[model samples]
Target: MSAPRFGRIGEGPAAPPGGEAFSELLAGGGARVVRIASRGHADAEGAWYDQAEDEFVLLLAGAARLEFAEGTARALAPGDWAVIPARCRHRVAWTDPGRETLWLAVHLPPH
Candidate 1:
């Protein structure tokens, strides 16, 4: 089969807080690759992601903080990588509006 494709990053749509902007790079069977960008605000609310999927996030730019419902928090900087387990209640606590936070998100089933 042919490989999947993706558009240029600058050509992608703008993402808003509490939401995300992404461009699919690959997809097949039960796995997908996407480039995402988020500019979460200080008051951004947390959301419950699907409990059956694991997500790998790479920070490409800017800075932010991630907090989990279990009371764990971490500061994320450029080039930082985080693997959020399935069913984790997490949210962005702070973000630098002066800089855009670019992320590469890989979503896959639990290994």
Candidate 2:
């Protein structure tokens, strides 16, 4: 049997210049857990993400906004969360520039 581990989710380096930092915390059985750190980052104009796996995201610090291809948007604050279904077109619209915005993401097989 595998032993349990302990770690802090919010502990990580700052995002790199002009890009967010993504770290895979765990992966198994076709599911993955990731940590994302962003600061003043946003998707390129007219760009969107259409992923094959469903994503569940939770904001742990700072703030962010997500825009969808369906002409909708959602703002997220600390402790907020959202579920993006597979193939749902979306993009990171905005992130707090003054400080790092931390996120916890779980990618799961499409249902």
Candidate 3:
């Protein structure tokens, strides 16, 4: 099998059940890059992600809404980008179901 291409990977819902699709594109030096695909996916009510790594996410296709623990929510469309600090809780609020929402996320290990 050949290595995966960022723009060529299959997108949409997870093949199994109860999850979005996540593919790790790169990992090294305590940093990781990932691709996430959401097809009408959202975080469970009151669920938040508190991570030790800082994340910078770019919306590559479709649209989404992200809510943060700081009581802020932002709509993201194609070409939109967001920088989330380490341990800053956040959650996926919504995504378009008609099409896949693709995201390129870079996770930098906390210092």
Best by lDDT: 2
Q: Residue 17 error for model 1, in Å? A: 6.9
Ranking by TM-score: 2, 3, 1
Residue pairs with backbone overlap in model 3? none
Error of 1 at 15 (Å): 3.1
Clashing pairs in 2: none
| Model 1 misplaced stretches (Cα beyond 4 Å) | 1-11, 16-19, 40-43
Model 3 stretches with alpha carbons more than 4 Å out: 1-19
Model 2: per-residue lDDT, tens digit, 1-111? Answer: 999988888787678645699989999989999999999999997799999999999999989999999999999999999999999999999998888899999999766
Give the TM-scores of the predictions, in the order they appear.
Answer: 0.76, 0.94, 0.84
Model 3 TM: 0.84
| Candidate models: Cα lDDT each | 0.73, 0.92, 0.85
lDDT of 3: 0.85
Query: Which run of 10 residues does model 2 get worst, by summed lDDT?
Result: 10-19
**Candidate 2 C-alpha error for residue 102, in Å:** 0.3
Q: State the lDDT of candidate 1 residue by residue for 15-60, as single tens digits.
A: 6864567778777677778786766555446563444678888888
- Distance from true location, Cα of 110 in model 2, Å: 3.3
